[model samples]
Each structure stands twice: as structure tokens, then as C-alpha cells.
Target: MKPLSIITLDQISDALDSIDLLGEMRSAFIAYSSGRSVIPPVGELIIDEQPPGEVHIKYGYVRGGAHYVVKIASGFPRNQELGLPPGNGMMILFDVSNGSISSILLDEGQLTDVRTAAAGALASSVLGVPGARVGIIGTGVQARLQAVHHASALDRDDLMVWGRNLGKCSLLASDLEAHGLKVEIAESAEELAERCRTIVTCTASHTPLLTRPMIQPGTHVTAVGSDTPDKQELDPRILGSADLVVVDSLSQGLVRGEVARSIDAGTITPGRVVELGQILDGSNPGRSDPNHCTVADLTGVAVQDLFIAEAVARSLV
Candidate 1:
């Protein structure tokens, strides 16, 4: 029997630096949408205690892949108050040939954060305008990753950011500036949306932050929050008014995310939603008109976890 390999957070982060994270994420989405991967629906546990938290169980396997992965990640909004990080979790990797546990990736949710940010960047590159200034909503860890990943992917340094708390927004802007991005702190979500053509929302808000009136023509919105049925970031009407609406997974989108909320509100129909994989695979025309307002609601799929875990594991080897 082969000994199990235990990987730490630092090792995982270092491995990711050398990996083509965006390309891996792009492939994950394509495989999932093309029916080349087996990803079960996400299992979630919502904590209603003070300073609420949520735990997500996401796992999957790619057809003909050497390993299967099960990832457990969590988010607690007020963890900073307790002098701890907001996100934490790990991934378990198993060998497919012998059904043996091959490795334990103690990433503590860093993999999830990076993979999600990579997905956001992928969405921006495919749907957004070239050289457009990016707007980021929310000042959480995901917000910082989204800004950094989008900057790297789009090859743009200018960013506008908005958050409910001004102090956190300032901190995030300073942190982004250290990464060589010229960051602008917006006074409000509306102000941020008004200034940038490409917007990424990575908040934990249960209410709508970007409304229909705030979005301009030729704008592309990539929303990575609202992974649960109750969490929402965009006004459903904004999706209804979008010329193109894309999701990471049609099955996940119809049950959660902005698409589900919009459908519940009778603003958008499921038939109108296109999978990002379809666009990547060239089966669907995405953003036929540059002036079209596009929105991508990503609820975070398990295949993403599988791909990132596999990539990190391979890099370590």
C-alpha cells in the first residue's frame, strides 16, 4: 500500500502559483458542461448562530481521471472579530484505480477561493470588453482574489471597489495597490457600477446590491456570491434585463444563485440561461453584440474543486 501524502496550505498555495489555474478552471467548466465529468449537487449546512457561517461539501470526478476529490469548505463572516480567517476547509483525494486515499490537501479553503476567482476571471475574459476598467463589489477575501485574478487575466490595472464597510474597502484597495493595480474606492455600489464596464460581485449579502438601473449598456456582471438559495447579490430584474445570462451549471443555477431567484420572481426563464461550458465549447454564441449587458451567475461547482485539487496534487508530485 502506498503511504498517504499530506499537503499543507503553504504547499498548496505554492503549487498553485506554477499551475495554469485559469486554464484548469476553464477545462473544469468545459468538462462539466460537456458531460465529461461527474459532479453531484452541492451539500450545504447553514449556521444560523450569531455571526452566521455556512459549510459546503463539494466533490466530483472527471471521466478517465486518475483521482476523485471531495472538498469541504466553510465561511464565517465575523471570524475577523475573533482574530481568525473567515474561510477554512480541506480536500481529500483518492486513487481511482484501487479506491485508496491518496492525499489530504489541507488548503483551508484557499483552493476554493482561488478556483472561484479563476472562474470569475474566465467569465470576465469571455464576456467582458477588452481593456475595460473593472468594478468589484464586497471587500472580503474573495473580493481581493477576484480583483487580483481579473487584473492578471484581463491585463488591466485599474479597479474600482465598493463594500458596505468603508474601512474594509480602503484596506482592500491598499492591498490591491500593492499588487500593482490602481485601485479606486467607490462610495457606493451604484457608483462603482456606473464607472466600470466589467463588474464582479463577491459578497455575502442576502439582499440585492446591484440594481437594474445601475447597470449600463455594454456592461458585463460576473456574480460569484449567492451560492445558496437564500443568498442574493443582484436584483433579479437586472438579470431579466440582461441581453445574455450565463451560468456555470444549469442544474445548480435553476435551484440556487441569481437565476433561481430571478425565475422565482418571474423575471427570467431557465430556457434563456446558457451554460458557460457551451460558450467555451463553441456550441452557443455568447455576447453576439458588444453592447449587450451580460451577467454570469456562478454558484461554485464541484468539478472546479476536483480539478484544482488534482492540479495541486500533481504539482506537488
Candidate 2:
């Protein structure tokens, strides 16, 4: 067995910042959805269900690659109560030929955060309205990165953030402000959806935080949370109202995301939900009208982690 190269969080952040992540993510999605990559069903384990935190074990290899990746990402809402970050985990790379471990990315789940935000930006790039204001629900790492990556990728400056905690929301806004990214704090998720043109719900709630009536017509929503069956951020009715709904992958979305909940309730059919790759591959037009509501549920596909983790590993070696 070879000694595994451990890539630290600092290295992970630097490597991620040094690449065209959103572009890479787009390519990975295209490959995954186009049958060019291998992504099996995700394995999950709930560590704490109270505030709803769980660990996901994802593994896959892109065809024609020398290495594959297996990532274990965990999120615990009580971590903050323990004075630690709510997310922690790592990704391991293996040489496909002999199944030997190649490297370990101890990113502390920063890679997931980056990839998730990159997916948000990708969805916005394809479906977001021009000069539209972006809104983020939740005051966690995802909320901050959504504003950062979405603003950069979509080239939209106006942004707002909403959360159940005013202090956290204000702090997030202030941090973004210090970086020249102006953001306002919304009183609630409902207010954020009504006031902002585009919204991304990044909460860890087991219940729906953003409902149907709170959303206005022509809104673009990227639901980044709810990767587990027990966790949902957007109300299923919102999925029923969307003119077009996209997912990182159809298979994953049908089982765990808001799409799953919507499907189970018969609010929307499986055929109604499409993969974002189809939009990128020119097979499906994502959102044709700027005034039509669109929704994209991202349940954190393995291809994303595979692509980015491999990229980070390559940069190091």
C-alpha cells in the first residue's frame, strides 16, 4: 500500500480557487448525464437527526480516468453549539487500475461547499435572468458561497441573504460587504423570495422553509439543501409551479431532493423534471423565458465531488 498524500484544507482552498470550477462542474455534469461517467446510488447515514445532520458516502469514476474518488461528507447543525463548524469530512482518491489509494483530501468539506456553490452558479448561468437580484436562504457557509459564486458566475451584483437567525444573517451580510459584495438581510425566507428575483435555499431543515405563496412568478430557485430524504428546503408546491425544473442528475433527484418529495406527493411527474446536463448538452432548453419560474434541485452528485477532488489531487501531484 502506498502512503496516501493528505491534502489539507488550505491546499484544498487554494487549489479550488485556482481553477475554473464552475466550468469544470458543468463538464462533469454533462459527462455524468450523457452516460459518459459512472455514478452509483449514494450511501447515507444520519449522525444526528434533531437539527438534521448526516454523513454521505459517495463514490464514482469518470470513464477513461486513471483514478476514482470516494468522498465522505458530514454536516451537524449542533457543531456550532459545540463551537465548531457544522460541516466536516474528506475525499479519498484511488488508482483505478489496481485499486490502491492514491490520495486523501482532508478538505473538511470545503470541496463540497465549493462544488455546491459552483452548481448554484452553473444553474444561474443557464437560467437566471439578466441583471437579476440573487437571494440566499440560510446564514451558513453555503449562503455565503452562493452569494459569492452566483454573483461571479452570473455577473449579477445585487444580492440578499435570509436566515432564521438575524445575528448570523447580519454577520454574513457584513462579511460580504467587507469584500465589496453588497448584500441585504431579509427578515425571513418568505420575504427573501418575494423581494429578490432569484433565490437559493441552503438550509438544513427537515421541513420546507420556502413555500409556494411566498414565491413570486418568474423566480429562479436553486435548492441546495435537502440531500437526505428527511431534509427539504423548498415546499413541494414550489416544484409544482416551476415552468422548468432541473436537477444535477435525474436519478439522484428522484430519490432524495425536493423533486423526490414532489414526486411522492404527485405534485410533479418524473418526466417534468430534467437534468441540468440536458440543458448544457443542448438537448433541453433550460429556461427560455426570463419571466417564467425555474427550479433546480441539487442533491450533491458524486460526479461533482469526483471531478473537483480529482482536479485538486492533480494540482498537488
Using lDDT as the measure, the top candidate is: 1
lDDT, candidate 2, 124-213, per-residue tens: 778877777899998889989988998898787778898888898899999899878878888778788888878888888888998889
lDDT by residue for model 1 over 134-236, one digit each (tens)?
9999898999999999999999989999999999999999999998899989989989888999999999889999999999999999999899998899999
Pairs that collide in candidate 2 are: none
True lDDT of residue 98, candidate 1: 80
The most accurate candidate by TM-score is 1
Worst 10 residues of 2 by lDDT: 46-55
Q: Candidate 1: which stretches are off by over 4 Å?
A: none
Whole-model Cα lDDT per candidate?
Answer: 0.93, 0.87
TM-score of 2: 0.95
